[model samples]
Target: MSGIVFAIPGDIDAPTGGYGYDRRLLREWHEAGIEARHIALPGSFPFPTEADLATTERLLAATAPDDVLLVDGLAFGAFPEALAARFADRLVALVHHPLAMETGLKPEAADTLRRSERLALARARTIVASSPTTRATLETEFGVPASEIVVAAPGCDPAPRASGSRGGAPLRLLAVGSLIPRKGYGDLVEAAAAIADRAWTLTIAGSPDHAPETAAQLRSVIARDGLADRIVLAGAVGPDKLAQLYDEADLFVMPSLYEGYGMVLTEALARGLPIVTTLSGAGAEALPDAAALKVPPGDAAALAKALARLIDAPAERRQRADAAWAAAGDLPRWSETARIVAEACLRDRASARNAARGFREKPMQDQRAREQD
Candidate 1:
């Protein structure tokens, strides 16, 4: 087996869904006897410095021509033309989400990002998207050929069933995702305020540092709404604590405006927690109709109403939790996710090798024909 290098631009174990996926996939692949390894790049992705570019050049230059390099799109999608063209031959892009589509970017800046990503992705032999929704966007919006794109959704680890907020306890709501503008956390706060009359408390556990200003803003909102006690910003938590939160919680709610795959939703499902999330990006696709109550993105009023209804109906919540548990049985495992990506990369490597051989042979055949004539 040839080398498999994951060229991620930050810590593989970062407290986020995409990083978690990369870490799990690489670990699983290594366990399955693949020559998988991680290569760290500059952490300041999507806006790397000159030193970062220099490091990338040196690293790619050192990679064996036969080796497969999987570049996380956070860094790869924003690569300049020269950097991208240098190692384009064997590069495979792991696109968690399109950088251009993230919220809070100015139109001009978004266009620039779109252009750069298109160029960067054009060099990849194939783009492995986290979901079908992302794959479609790659083909239609980014001009990537449909044949050059693949979809491999994230996997979920099975978790202890949630104990549920029963026995006259206040309904517990959990929303997980990094605190960024795109996640619609403001909407979540508003929705929480709307349901202020109900017996519920909300916990948002995510990487507050990912967007510090947003975190501060959320704190301000919590204070302004007089929900400082009711709404707790748990900040970035470890796996053990997160699982404990899940086990103790009653409901999973997310107001994200978009997601590449919304791996947390699957995690929520794995724990048999009924969900109340907006129908946005892959989050909508991952959620089963029976397992969740879906609402449009940015509609705090509707979100609040949904929460209120579920709070009043204990039987319905129980039924939905049961449905979520049933759905968990069929969720993809980490091993399967790793196998899919490994197989895709290996398959394309072989195809590229065969095509190169055919190209080399074509001239000889043409010369033989000329001599016969």
Candidate 2:
């Protein structure tokens, strides 16, 4: 009776990082003996139509007043007013990142999402940001109280160590993320172009379906630079295939403009792959400088320089990969994540029940004091 009612906007089995995290957490929580019920709220997400909003309202409205409702910020961000009127007392928000900060959104759309997200987050009993950076952003930028937010960073599962290229030519580079503007796939492609003269092959594994236009533009960039033959857009592979890529790769690269928590970075570490990534959002927090060659976000020149250095120096790549392997020991695993989230839920429910009990006893205590007086 005291379990989570987890809700998401679309297919929970989707291959994106957010949905991946969701699927992994649910599996972990269930393994830990938490009876979590999942409800899929069908919609396009962060841009839900009016009908979608109505559907969400009904879905939430059907929950018992005492039921614990955990909403993904994607859904809540779209229609906060509905949340304000419905499930304020027992709502917990899982925020990947503030929707308003997403790249390619217009000023007015961003403004509207910002206001709604801030208000919706305020209505939740507790909010869990996916990274410390995200937690800080929610606290400072969104005005959510520091005490109300929890930083339950994404978890990593163990994988086989990457058997690298063994100090040779044609260095293999792997990047994973959806082909979106914010993911900076275009920047990554442009950077690879600078080092086209070198012996390297870039394989970008992501879902181009997320943003076909961005994916098309990324292809255009590759074609324009005449490196189309060198870069391969292996659209969204399975875990087995991804793990195989990690095994086959000499280095891991993610040129994301922002990440709530760079799940792919942790994934790269799980395989002990050397990384050349931008120090944006949670990317730096995911891997240290000794473990990665970090560059400035959106700077193709700097990204290219980082990539070229690693490509040229096999010993340096080995050293960085070794450091990453060592540091991978400190990375939080899925069980730990499940435990942290379960404890938070249990603690929140305990507090809510204690408050309710105290409220029930208050009148009796007052009457007793009056009689004595």
Candidate 3:
């Protein structure tokens, strides 16, 4: 059997969550004996530009008709109808989260994007979401039938790192994600401020892409809260550096306002780090009950309380960390995720071929004429 080919528009350079998911998916597909390729699209603001469209067109023209085109949510959300029409027969869209529903966008812009997403999803041969929350939203918000959508949760790297020595004085806390409003970093900074007198240091690591204003606001908050000395912004570190940080950290916090599926949470869990997060999206669903400390989104006081609890109770923290490590062991590997995706793509392709053959064998108009006769 010929292998599946995925045409993803996720940028390879940046450290975005979607890019991480795509990277892992591709790795998994290859391990599962599925031939998968990612076509990088040009970077554009808000949506894919004319250049991106042209690049996608070129890729489509070159690809075999039977090859599965796995479109990422970013590109699908950006140019829904056109992509759907162009690759209607062999297209499967992977939605991490609904970009149109993010709170940061203007009402009119959000509405336009949402409309485009609906149209694009409708045109897909199959739609795979990263979380059940996303699947439900697709059915409820976009009116997509439940039967057409499948939920394939994101996977984490399984390798364990050697334990690093904890430095003296301050307890180390790490938060990793793009420095944006949705990440709730500003709120975390505020929470950090509330406990500034405590001996704890925070490292915020991620590349900034969207909402420069939010990044600016977070910086301002950090300075104003007198956390300048305690907080550090380590922008866009490589995987090795990130693994080192995770190994060294005493705690991990991701107070995201929303997520499709939180791959970072899984990564942190894999490192055996106790976590603090909000109940925002499907990503939060990955949290093991005993391993995580939950707080309401945008609530600095609650976050502060959670942080304080973790800091003050050393024995409990260690226990939670141990539990987190054990829970991480249960997460699906990239190879497993790839196998499921490859199987789904193969099934969709076979279904499309059968439908096409049926259409050719019995013309609808001819059947209607025979009924009349």
The candidate that achieves the highest lDDT relative to the unseen native structure:
1
lDDT of 3 by residue, 1-373 (tens): 4445666665665687778778877765554445667776555623777777787778776877777778778777776587678888888888888878776888988888999888888898888888889999999998889988878787666556426346576889999998877888878998888887778999999876567788888888888877888899888889889888887788999988888778888888877888888877766765887988988888989999999899888898888899987876566655445555665676556643532342342234433433353
Estimate, for each residue in 112-220, the C-alpha lDDT of model 1 and write its tens digit. Answer: 8899999999898777998999998998899999988878888776566898666887889999888999999999999889879888889999998888899899999
TM-score of model 2 vs. true structure: 0.91
Order the candidate numbers by TM-score, best to worst: 1, 2, 3
The residue pairs found clashing in candidate 1 are: none
Worst 10 residues of 2 by lDDT: 354-363
Which sequence of candidate numbers ranks them by lDDT, best first? 1, 2, 3
After superposition, candidate 2 runs with Cα above 4 Å error: 166-169, 347-373
Local error of candidate 1 at residue 227 (angstroms):
0.4
Quote the RMSD, in angstroms, for model 1. 10.9
The candidate with the higher TM-score, 1 or 3, is 1
- Using TM-score as the measure, name the better of candidate 2 and candidate 3: 2
Worst 10 residues of 3 by lDDT: 354-363
The TM-score between candidate 1 and the true structure equals 0.92
Using lDDT as the yardstick, the better of models 2 and 3 is 2
Q: Which candidate is the best by TM-score?
A: 1
